[model samples]
Target: MAQKNYSGVNISVDEEGYMTDSSQWTKEIAKEMAKEEGLNLTEEHIKLLEFIREKVLSGSALTIRAIGKSGFTDIKGFYQLFPGAPLKKATKYAGVSKPSTCV
Candidate 1:
């Protein structure tokens, strides 16, 4: 696997898999990926997107349940956005998890 930068979006593949740029990844792409992961992009997806985008903008991380609690109602759909993401590190990447949350 190799790291790729698409339109300034950085990403890497861990397998013999091909890597794609997060920059090229649009809401539509996310929607499709969510569907493939068994998610229905209802308001939950929209909220997740908003949270992720916000974290990205603020240099932070976002969590499935936290974002869900923010306004979304579908935990299942939130998980679909990142089916393979580890539970703990999910917010670490977005830098959304604060010291308080960890404790």
Candidate 2:
């Protein structure tokens, strides 16, 4: 799989299986990704991802657990947003860290 370079603020694929993108997985990108994932882009999805990213970026990485308290009613809300897009890869796309997978 191709990886993203996180050494800078731009999204880049690395020569090796490494990702170096910062992880900012904002609401906008997540919405687009969800749309591509066959999910309907709804306020619920946006709200969920935004909530997830906010919590995740402010401190520790967010596992599914952290998102439970957010007003989604189900994991479907998260999938509709993030959809297993890979936090590391999304972060890389956001230029936060190197990504080990593609989002």
Candidate 3:
């Protein structure tokens, strides 16, 4: 694990930069992470991130197909939102672990 500063808070993260403690997450931290990824998060993005966090916290498997069925956005839209690696990026920004489905 490593410590990263975001929104002036030092957060614990894995070697891959995924947050190690979801309770330490904040919207400001998410925005900072998104900005680092060249994204300017909008309300839709926040909503989708929230959905991802909720599902992960509930011990549900995260997958592109499940996200598509989430009504938050379809698979194509998810790809559009996170671009190159949707599930990886989304879970990272959502302050959750990388989904087992991601490379």
Q: Which numbered prediction scores highest in lDDT against the true structure?
A: 3
RMSD of each: 6.6, 6.9, 1.6
Candidate 2 per-residue lDDT, tens place, 1-103, comes to: 4533222323434553223342534445544444444655566555554554456456555555455555564555544445575444334233233422223
The 0-to-1 C-alpha lDDT of every candidate, in the order given, reads 0.46, 0.45, 0.92
For candidate 2, what is the lDDT?
A: 0.45
lDDT of 1 by residue, 1-103 (tens): 5664433545563332222333444555444434544655555445556566575456544455655675544666546554665333232222233213343
lDDT per residue for candidate 3 within 28-77, as digits (tens), equals 99999999979988989999999999999999888899999999899999
Specify the highest-TM-score model's number: 3
Candidate 2's TM-score: 0.46
Q: What RMSD does model 1 have?
A: 6.6
Clashing pairs in 1: 60-94, 60-95, 61-94, 61-95, 61-96
Each prediction's TM-score versus the true structure:
0.44, 0.46, 0.94
Write down the TM-score for model 3.
0.94
lDDT of 3 at 57: 95
Q: Rank the candidates by lDDT, best first.
A: 3, 1, 2
* Positional deviation of residue 30's Cα in model 3 after best superposition, in angstroms: 0.5
